[model samples]
Target: MALPNRLRRLLLGSDPRLARMLGYWAATCLLYFIGAALLILQVRAGAADHDSAVLLIGIGATGVAVFAVLVRASIVMGIAPSTLAAWQALFAIACNIGAYVVTGPLRGVYLIFLLVVLVFCTFSLRPRHTMLLCAYTLGILGATMVWLVATYPATYPAYVEGVHFASAACALISVTLLTGEMSKLRLRLKQQKEDLLAAMATIRKLATVDELTSLANRRHMNEVLVAQERRIDPAGQPTCLALIDLDFFKSVNDRYGHAAGDAVLRAFSAAARSELRAQDVLARWGGEEFLLLLPATTMTQAILVVERMAERVAAAPVAEISGGMRITFSAGLAQRHDREPFADTINRADKALYNAKSTGRNRISLG
Candidate 1:
């Protein structure tokens, strides 16, 4: 395990994808060794000449070294691994076919290894490409069989080559079809996994976001406040909370339609978002009421932010179809005391908000 890990680091650098593809490349190189061994075995059986087997072994060894270098270079250059793997597949098929043509009486051994080529391709190539390689293998081997029967009828009888070709074709085509089905299954499973992840993300967004205003909903805001309460720092800048209520919002719905009332709320939320600082949070606290959280803000700064938000709302027509009526919200601000419970600070702000509503509709009051 340690040696393979070190080899992967040295050869493939740090990319796990590259390392996996290199493993496939190594298997094809191993097939080259197996082919050479088969040929050497045939030489000992007197089915192929010693000189021919030795020469082919040397060529196979050199081909492995060359492709290893090419694979290493492709990894370093960030080239697509499949592209080089395609080239290696072609090289392997050609070498396997050459070995089959030379191995006299024991050439059928190389036909079995041709199926190994298709298996390699099932992992490395697209299904269609693998099937295409299968067809190429059939065509080339058919041609070789015809040539062998004509040139060396004593060694490769016509009926013998025919049976060999038929058997090899059956095995190759069967594996190709199986690999095609497997590839589709793998693709379908991957797409379903992606869809599941996306649906989970949508569920999370609906949990946090208000349906109408797209602001944080009440439950999510409470979670934020609870988190904020846990991390209060006395020496750090103060945090402020403001409870805001839309003035006469029920009357607006009574005068105009609910659609116009909804439009006003949406437009007001948009404006509030634009006016608030990035660190601030505003939540829709159910039906024309909202809570604003201003981190690192004093009461004075919170009041200024609330006042600016009020002026911005008055400057724009929140509901153009409702005679372009301006909207106003009364707010009450409270600077959070160190170690004070968040609920108590909110209660003080809510109480002060009632005072602002009782005195005048558009003004802010500090708690």
Candidate 2:
């Protein structure tokens, strides 16, 4: 058998934004570590000339690794505060600028780190924090470019001016594309949340409804009765309870089978439902049994209503079942009185129904 849906979601799935952020950060850190190690190795090959620089680069690489580990751990443990995430972003940008200064120029490869870091920040951080971090990153990148132009004029020689200009253009384009992608992700997440809520509401409604009869089931009737009781104005209105039991229902099921019995039940419910007024509530209480709650109705008024319902059920013929047999119901009606408990009223109605069933099966009895 397949795994349950919730288990699958828990074990094999992740939030899209978080997954993207994790991948971007993991790849970026790995690349930076590898690049830094290569640079240190090259300097070590010429250690006689660049001993101090080689040692410094190795230290910076180790620092980056350590910071990455700390941030990853905090996020995994759900302990990374928003303020700490902002500080981490600022620190990473500062370290990037420091690396460029140590190397005497800003290489295009540094842009890769900046772009990856920006994507990761957008995914991991909130909108306000991510934008603030983005601003800081742009500022640091600008400063690094200015430093390169001032300290290493030949690095951006005027003879190849277009190359330097084109790199800047590319950086702008990358930032634009990444921002649009983030916006799309946000929209998608919002839509997913709405869809989930709608599905849950539909499921809840279906739980309280009978599939075949389209009537309120037992559980739903109980809930509605309690809610109505709480809303009852003790001085202004009265609520009546009625128990309706279908007569000779088992005979129909025994003769025509369950499918035919279902059809007859549905037909009876539809006919009975048509006889009810807007202020009344009806539910399928159990097999061959139904309950009705009539608000602002007295015993006489409730009897008339129950009699009409009984007449409707008795008159309605269920075709394609039991030689098109006619169905009949017996109902017992009781009205709420001052100082009477709700449960007691229901018991009185039930007793009235028992009396009605004993006297004859196709009429309404009042208590």
Candidate 3:
């Protein structure tokens, strides 16, 4: 048999963290590949010593692969996702700066390549972590500048100064591009999440709440009542039920209109909801009728609650109608004192409600 949508989502589509982890790992691997390839090409092109070129490429590739593995492992162990990404970016920045320190930033376009990798790392990581990594990177660059000025002033002569300036420009440009892309992606993802939550809320309301009265609907009520029955003590404490019916509800519709009737219903619902205890479950059983289930309440207590609610409804003014139509409700209370079936309890409540209606128009009765 085919799985239901909810089951499918829970089983196959709900693991967001896995996607994030895998995506990050894949991007890291891709960056490593690009950086390694560039390093190999750069070394070969600028090889005053051919043997050094092969050795440099092999060593750089192995070190980067090891770093990638360590970063991924650390993330899998116990690190927070954002923190892991930040550490990964920091490691990348450290690698780049370490290369610059060893191989002279004046090496034709090598600093530019390192700058690109640094930008990639910054953009790929979380914002606060990225900032910290950038600060560390800038510190490395500053230290490198100071070292060059102090020790190798002649090495980066007037000709090499232009190369260094161009390298800085490359770094700035790369950072700007990647930062812009990352920001846009973040905004899109956030909006998508908000939209998804709103849709879920709407779906939940449709499933569990009455559209007009905004009370728990029949389905939700059934779920709650069944769950309550499982935990209810038959011989221990009483379970009370209140069946409420709006008096002259059909006349309200006939006198004013359906819209005015809706207004009256909403007003009564609001009042009844406010009067209910936090533990009481209120449900719209059907049109013009509502049910309140109160566990661990005696028949007397339930009748008192019903009387108070009836008075409250009688006092609360209905919303504007064509005529000044007053609104009132009749309530019936029933409590299970001994072992009794759920249906019998509800039937007793209905009988009490009928008695309330028969005795007077607006009053409470108990059975």
Off by over 4 Å in 2: 1-168, 232-235
Flag the better candidate by TM-score, 1 or 3.
1
Candidate lDDT values, in order: 0.85, 0.70, 0.70
The top-ranked prediction according to TM-score is 1
lDDT of 2 at 124: 51
Listed in order, each prediction's TM-score against the native is 0.82, 0.54, 0.61
lDDT tens digits by residue: candidate 1, 1-367: 9999898689787867766776877887777877887888788888887887787778778888887787767756776766776777777777878888778777888888888777777665778888888899899989988998899898889999999999999999998899878876777887999999999998998999999999999999999999998884777889999999988889888888799789889988988888999999999998999999999998888888998999887776764446656788999889888878889999999989999999986889889
Question: Model 2, 235-350: lDDT tens per residue?
Answer: 67778999989888898788888888898889888998999999888888889888898988887888888888877877787775645467888888898877477688888989
For candidate 3, what is the total of clashing residue pairs?
0
* Candidate 3 lDDT by residue in tens digits, 88-126: 566665555555544543354445555555455543555
Among all windows of ten consecutive residues in candidate 1, which has the lowest summed lDDT? 316-325
Best-to-worst ranking by TM-score: 1, 3, 2
Best-matching candidate per lDDT: 1
- The stretch of ten residues in a row with the least summed lDDT in candidate 3 is 101-110
Candidate 1 regions with alpha-carbon error over 4 angstroms: 1-16, 36-85, 123-126, 232-235
